[model samples]
Target chain A: MPAPRPDGACRDEELLAAVILRLIAGLRHVAVGAQSPIPATAALLARHLGKGQPFVSLLSSARHNFFTDGGRELFDCAGQGRVDAFFLSGGQIDGAANINLVAIGDYAAPQVRFPGSFGSAYLYYVVPRVILFRLEHSRRTLVNKVDFISAPGTSPPGVYRPGGPVALVTNRCVFAFDRQRGRFRLESLHPGHTLEEVLDHTGFDFDRPERVPQTPSPSPEHLDLMRGVVAPLLAEVYPQFAATVFGFTRQEQS
Target chain B: MSAIFRSLDEALAGIGDGAMLVVPPEYGGVAMEATRALIRRGLRDLHLVTLPASSLQADLLIGAGAVATIETSAVSLGEFGPAPRFAAAVTSGKIRIKDATCPAIHAALQAAEKGVPFMPLRGLVGSDLVARRPDWRVIDNPFAARDPIVLLPAIRPDVALFHAPMADRNGNVWIGRRRELATMAHAAAKTVVTVERIHDGDLLATEASAAGVLPALYVEAVAAAPRGAWPLPLAGEYPRDEAHCAEYARLAATEEGFRRYLDRYVYARAAA
Candidate 1:
């Protein structure tokens, strides 16, 4: 059997780094919202891939508030009708493809508004394909229907919405929603996650893969790039990110 | 051409002397003149009350000494150019940077949009941003029953400039992706649009949905100049000029190098 990947063999940062590599391998562009994980990962991926993605390049700029700028190629928002794929993370998303970045309850005083819809509001309208990637999926975070459609899923799919939240990549499995109904269905499972694990987190009944396949593990070449190219620069460009995501130092191992 | 501007001077006429222009955010600087035409303008003494700047626009604002201070949302404009010098300046009291976030800036611009004195906000609890900005007053949630809220005084700029994919003669702006920035600008004062082309309603006729991408209500003037995003790219327009961009990257590596490049390009060529 192939040697099992060990935490000691790879840093904690590799989890996110590898995920980023996996997401960015074939995709050309990915829009990142404020404090959203997809953009964070795409930023690292761009650094790994190279520079010059338009809006992706100038993330701090309001113009790049939505859309992907992988290297020099900037993808337009779905509303303006320009996007191939994008990712959404760091917030609770529900079955209807609606999301909540504001307070769990009321817009005013609430459990937590986390951070008002980064770009989910408009991104929901504009970006054609938005992939929701959750690091932590729990019953508390994942719901049958999101409290708010921070960004609408298919926006009345109306026979030709043609664009909406496409995939939801989580720690356990990959899922997709019906174009018209915005219902959830399991697409694929990660290496470590199981059907029960997936069931435990989702609030709705989902169509799972009959013979689910293992989540594609990061290749060694991808890992080497993750550790060497991504990790090193991440340390220089975003040291805090490196410290937080890849916290598997000797202290963590111990 | 947008037909809005009959002259090149009009095309490059957003910033005139001391204009309190907000650099919004650098999400591809969609608001910037294509190919970053603002870089070619070389304005000085621009009042930029903005976010924690993190990209080249932040660097350019600093380089031109135009940034008065920032009531910012973030300083993370992607990893490019030098680490923002404004943060250290604020910490050292050399510059005045009122820390805020996107919501704060949005409220400020909203206040501008409404021509109001101030707007109340929710966040800014126990944040270093609030502590850093001595002028910012945090008080009881006047809107709410009990909880406290953050009050950001209205900040209406004299003019606002943004880049768009296309615009019409009457100042109807249409953006490519999301219009978040456009909304932000709409909430600000005297909106100016810089677009790649002024579609004459030929192909745009069929694109009826895209006709009024940006309504005439907010935009005061429209400049339809191709490649307006310059270093940035418009959806169907030309991408960034890599050669000029490479030269910029090389020159902007150091303060001296940046200064020399700026001097050669901005200072020397007063007519640029």
Candidate 2:
């Protein structure tokens, strides 16, 4: 086997995608929503890796999407338990894994209103594995408690919930959410990020081991597939992301 | 009887101020031309419901003060960025926002289409969306043992409006595979359509075309409005005007810039 290359060779986006691919491991069907290039890349990579033969569906892409009923079909499939894994992000995320995608202040007159909840409230309850991802790991983003609960991380005891948050991946570290305990345990810190930095920047508290492991970088082969094969596929939908991250030429994209 | 109308303005005449209007997505078939006409006519206080989500159509309307309340899953510019006018309005509490998830909106509209009082759905039981919405109720499943589910009230709109690539002389609009528009027409009290062109023959005469045709029964008024979904795509017919959208997003970021955009695009288009 070839010697492991320096982590600097890999881009931050590629690393995040690799991290997400690990979290979504063993899932059969993974659906990604609009404006989520990192999750889209990870889903595509999972298909490329040929591990579980997970079927990837990117909603924004015309080629990858198989739904005929417009936007409603995705929700309908999620409702019937057809979708196995999905991704979500929020303007604010708390220790309990609750997300806030709506307004920041008063509901009537908000100081900051993120786009109203799309399908997060519904999909969060149905997709067996909902991976919460936020690239920015800061005090403002990872709050002690969200201003509004777009989707609560945990359901009541009697509620028939098949899905909830399984893991949270951010630029600083990875957090594993315990549904029963309703708390997050720090899983691993990303390379080049210090534990102290995460602690200072994070607004919410979480459990962590004495010794935290560094997040593993993507294998050279995985990087190759991501840049060469998956990048082109993603370019079909997220052209701008593909161009910026993988340096895909305009001629090649078209 | 045929449902054809002589003018676009006349076709949209039934959709007055404060009417609840249901429409499809930006790409599928959004009546952008009609939205501009409404702006031109100075229509106000309308309740706009995007079937699941919207793009520039909702933002443009809200920016123009044509909408008083918006009920939908989301309103985003897509690729361009967060919809500026929409974010501005929401932050300032200019218009009421009934925040909904995609499935809830679809389920409620489905109930309306089926003439049902309400529809039970899974997955909303633990969500804050359930607690916030008075129209949505959590009820125990009647048949299932010790089961709880969310029941959303039917969303019956006053007018279902959209643009299509073509409509036959019989007023059956060709929507291809985008069936949500048909559902919107079925759910709303009145349905008005604008098409790029009118096909000469009957759309439902052939097996292949029948699947694509939204039958004339649901469509009350049809007008020939070429390039109706400009600056936005109409599925297989035309592509989105990305440059125009970017310009709009850039200009609409600020209050002063948004007014300039209104002057240049919305008002100028109306004048033209």
Best by DockQ: 2
Off by over 4 Å in 1: A1-13, A17-254, B1-3, B6-8, B11-14, B28-42, B51-54, B75-77, B84-95, B142-145, B202-212, B235-250, B263-272
Candidate 2 chain A — worst ten consecutive residues by lDDT sum?
Answer: A1-10
Docking quality level of the chain pair in candidate 2 = medium
- Off by more than 4 A, model 2: A1-8, A249-254, B1-5, B270-272
For the second chain, the TM-scores of the candidates in order are 0.76, 0.96
TM-score winner among the candidates? 2
Q: List fnat per candidate, in order.
A: 0.02, 0.77
Per-model TM-score on C-alpha atoms = 0.52, 0.93
TM-score of 1: 0.52
Highest-lDDT candidate: 2
Question: For candidate 2, what is the lDDT?
Answer: 0.86
Q: What is the C-alpha lDDT of each candidate?
A: 0.53, 0.86
Per-residue accuracy of model 2 over B95-198 as CA lDDT, tens digit each = 98888888888889899999999998887776667767888898889998789988999999999999998988888889887888888888999999999998
